[model samples]
Target chain A: MSLPRHVIAPAIAVLAASGALLRRSRRRQRSRNPRPASTREWTRHPVGLVAGREIRQRLRSRSFSISVLITVVAVAAIIVIPSFHHTSALRVRVGVAPGTPSATSALITRDAHALGVVTTITSFPSVSALESALHRSVDLAVLSSQELLTYGGLGASGSSGSNFLTSLSLSLGQASALSAAHLSPSQLQTLQSAHPFRIVALHPPTPRRSVDPLALVGVIVMFMMVNQYAQWILLGVMEEKSSRVVEVLLSGLRPVEMIGGKVSGIGFVALLQGGLTIASALIASYAVGSPLVQTHASWTLAALILWFLLGYVFYSWVFAAVGSMVERIDQAQSLALPFSLPLFAGYIYSIFEASSTTVSTLYRALAYFPPTALFAMPTLVSRGDVGPLGFSVSVAIDLVTTVLVARLAAGIYRRAILHTGSRVRWGDVLRRGR
Target chain B: MPVLDISGLRRRFGDLVALDGLSFTVASGVVTGFLGPNGAGKTTTMRAIFGLVDLDEGDIRVDGHPVDAARRQRFGYMPEERGLYPTMKILDQVEYFGRLHGLSRADARSKGAEWLTRLGLEGREDAKVDELSHGNQQRVQLATALVHDPDILILDEPLSGLDPTGIDDIGAIIVERAREGRAVVFSSHQLDLVENLCDVVTIIDHGRVVAHGTVDELASAGQPRLTVRVEGDREGRWAASLPGVTVSEINGGEVRLVLEDHVDTDLVLSAARAAGRVTEFSLHRRRLSEVFRESLS
Candidate 1:
């Protein structure tokens, strides 16, 4: 998937020009309305200037635009391709042994219809003939007065077919027993239509284990986006430091302003790309009439975006601080390993937990922890396992932790950014006071 | 009043002391040349003035007030290691720095364009910084520092890697900025160039200011030297034997002599004329290189 040079060249030019124009307009507007001297004076501070530069530089970058385009294309493909594949009608083939009553064939067809699977039935003269027919074209086989054989084996278990087939076989067995007992048609009908015994519980029952495809997609997207964009913030900081551009910037701006502006700028770009990708996917799904849209809709989408933002904010500060401690890109990689451990743990844990109905106490606890909450809480929310109290608690914890981490990160960044060398240790940066 | 004043400044990087009680004053409307050997703390002093490096025990005052972020923003600083976003256009990069210095976007942009044009980078503003030649990139770096119309400009090694033309262009800009009543401070190893461009020279060695004065004041502190050129004597063989005069060199028809204290310079001039025919006789002020080398030693 490579684009032609001529196409890429013009596209790059247009993007760069538009970005420049947007930046120029914002700067002009800001200049036109200088804030009065007050606490709000920070609005016209150097932080905004630095952030504006970061945003303009990143938005116009070739890698950023290319990655965004790829994400949109991938999301569209995921939605549209599956819809095209499952568009045709689904049919199950049933083979009946010769002399097996026509009524049984009608029963199987009715059951399959009730389950929304169309049926094609065939009869043969002997059991061996029926077995051969089953092997040749049928999804399941019925031997006269004997057993139900499926592609899974001679038994009815483990076969990929409708539950209607299992119920039909059980009903047939009961019908045979009633006939042996010499029951009349009215008695048979009564037995066939009889309701089962019911068991009630004092508490609402937990839902059965089932995979929510939307939850799986949501968690995965959140994990990838948080990790990817956080790394971008780290790399951007490292580049500025190693290039010694930070020295010039620090001469005019405070360290806190520089770090704040950078993280916010990159974070905004991340949200834009993520939002565009998700929106394009939804549009594609709607165009293709994908069941995904019907299943997840807006709630899950909103949770995914919100959680992504929380996760990005939580991680980007840590990354930016770590980025400031290291003078080179390679040093950043080695130092980032510790910072990224929790993100990786949450990502892997959420993916494995997304489909399971019952989760461990550890997994539940992680839903409240800030580092993992971004990954864990979203899955729990999508599954309806999270209550209002739990959601609020998790959000509160995450918010508090983000503020603490941001302050800590700012402190470290302010101290270490000026001390360029092999790599500034965390302990050293923390120990050095303002 | 000095636009920038530093006193008792001290900075240590672990075991190495980069600055030791370093002090200097830069007044407006003059080019103050900051001269130092490598590792002599000229850069450290400049960075301290802008609060880039935290001082161990001293204060830097700008316009009679302690330096702060707002005051520093009014000062332009160019580090020894030039840094600019390589992928950004020349004009945009300049304007960005100007904005960082508190100029509005419109002001920064117009000022950026004006500086680029003034610095002979008019047509290359749209080119990426990396796309320009090394000298042109240096020009853009200068434009970034100057676009805000700073009250005080501190440039560290601004002419380290430029051709003669580039050096002259930058020197002219420094003089122009000073002429506009903005104090300009620049560091360079090229002593003669500094001597020609600066009204005052502050030479530091081993993290301390060894000498500080106007070029003439410093040069005339010691015994005066004289260069006497004779038309008839190609080797100047007749002038070496004069009393109280040491002939530093006799190249072709020119004789360079250092006069000791109380030596009659009239006798030396008469001796030069008596040797043959006097073509030129003039007092030779001490060159900045000689002063710098003397200070370092």
Candidate 2:
């Protein structure tokens, strides 16, 4: 059918207009709805209730307030102290024959100066003297004889002779160059430039991401928050049962709500603390002018938040579930210990992976496990070990794990909350008492 | 309106049965005492009504609508095992629980202050629950349950550890609430208070209803028996001679008799008068405790 431009244009315009209108209407509806809950609506609004209760209650406590203040101060000191006081660049002492190779000597001083190493060349009388000077904390030593280079039972003819030959060759080369060249400094510069070498990197290709200090910081913070709040989840569950308040709480809330609320509550607080820490860290890092953070902080922050969420979902459930095992606070200590080990492993692996991303088999296995998934994936993503699809798949797997663990924890909590003053075994909580 | 009506409820806790076939109605404008001894399932009954404990069968309704576990926001209940965050300030704790019952923060806070003032805890609202004595903590527990303006109040051992003055204060509050046409049911071992406080009483023992009715009606449920303390002819022997009457115990001049439901009290008395001069003559009826005991047995 032949269509006129005016008719077709109006039709297309109408279609576009409807699309815009629909989007606007949907946005309006969302704003109109008072409940800000997500599609993955947390079962634990009560847990948020409980966690708000705990944090608001305990935030004013002598311990909580004091500890946070102290931590901020300590972190500030740690960041500031090393940068200003690192005086290792102040000076370097060297042992070299003064007259034997003036060109080499002059080159050494200039190169050392540029590197921020203040150089002092020494005129040693013998090879032994040069060795002694080298041993006396000189940064570098150049000798005319092979004796200093060759060490043994004061023996070995070939080694000693070759070392001396090498040393004499370097010194003689310096002398000839000085004679043939323009100035002593210029000749020394030539000798120093003769041995330029490439430093071969062991790290694999990571072109998509440049190095990021905040990424490491983000990983550390995520690991810490997950572990800290997991303990809170454990302790909260234990307290509900211990104080015999779960019965009352459970009356209005479901098992899912109970556990979900707890983890959500503690997780919310952890996130709050984490956000504050990050903001302050960025502010401080900004103030001090850290180069990596200045460039990639936004990326670091976004990754951190993602990792924090995934990590919390992964670990918080198990902690809540395990915490359900102990009706008494004392038993909770022992019950929580096994869960702590994975967190410990997560912490260690995260730190190790920060410097280099040679992830161990254990960490790879842990990445598959729910609790440590948050911890492992962030490290992988930070160091360029993960691609987009793989990252998403890992997150999808973690999402499934979160669901399963949530159900498992809820089941465990529901059964044991009523059974006070005794430990609830994992087997019983899962298998039958369910 | 009858605020709460629970019927045909059954619940068990592994091997041991907590409640079996329990039912009762709590009416507005009156205080109802749920009387039971230790392990008498009073707490379980309260919990079951609130859906605090899962029921194996039957239902509970509030204002004629079923009180589902999901609809628990309708009722206010104080469990036997009382709890509050030891670290939370009294005002915050009360307001928090009020909010849980679905009050806005501002509303809850204001209502919390009002209730605290009403509870005579005006100055101590900022104090932590742990700082309060057990009696005051009990008061805080009460404030938390009622701060949200709930229509139904179910309390298990509401006055378990209150001092005499504390008891009087709480009793006055409960009485005031009841006067305002609220449905209030509480279980207590304090018989005197129960007698003074409740209009309707439901007594359970060994997980079964023993006696349940108005105070006077429950007392008058059994047939009247006459106890005659006489100084003349052997009263016990004479009482045994009466139709359908059995003389059980004779302590000095005192005589106890078991009379059939059909036996006339006047006939037994006349016979006792003919046999001896009655020193102490009165209609012997079962007391509330006695009625409970007899029904349970």
In candidate 2, what are the lDDT values of residues B130-163, reduced to their tens digit? 8989999988888988887877788888888999
How accurate locally is residue B3 in candidate 2, as Cα lDDT from 0 to 100? 76
Number of the top TM-score candidate: 1
Q: Show pairs that collide, candidate 1.
A: B234-B252
**Segments in model 1 whose C-alpha atoms lie over 4 Å from true places:** A1-45, A77-113, A118-193, A199-207, A284-300, A325-327, A418-434, B228-282
On residues A115-142, what C-alpha lDDT tens digit does candidate 1 reach at each position? Answer: 6667788776688877776666877888
Model 2, range A157-269, lDDT digits (tens) per residue? 44432333344445556566566666767766766569768788899574444445666666666665676677777877777777666666665556765676566666666
Residue-level error in angstroms, candidate 2, position A433: 7.9
- Candidate 2 CAPRI level: acceptable
- Comparing only chain B with the true structure, the TM-scores of all models are 0.87, 0.81
Off by over 4 Å in 2: A1-51, A73-223, A245-261, A279-301, A324-327, A352-357, A425-428, A431-434, B226-258, B262-279
Worst 10 residues of 2 chain B by lDDT: B66-75
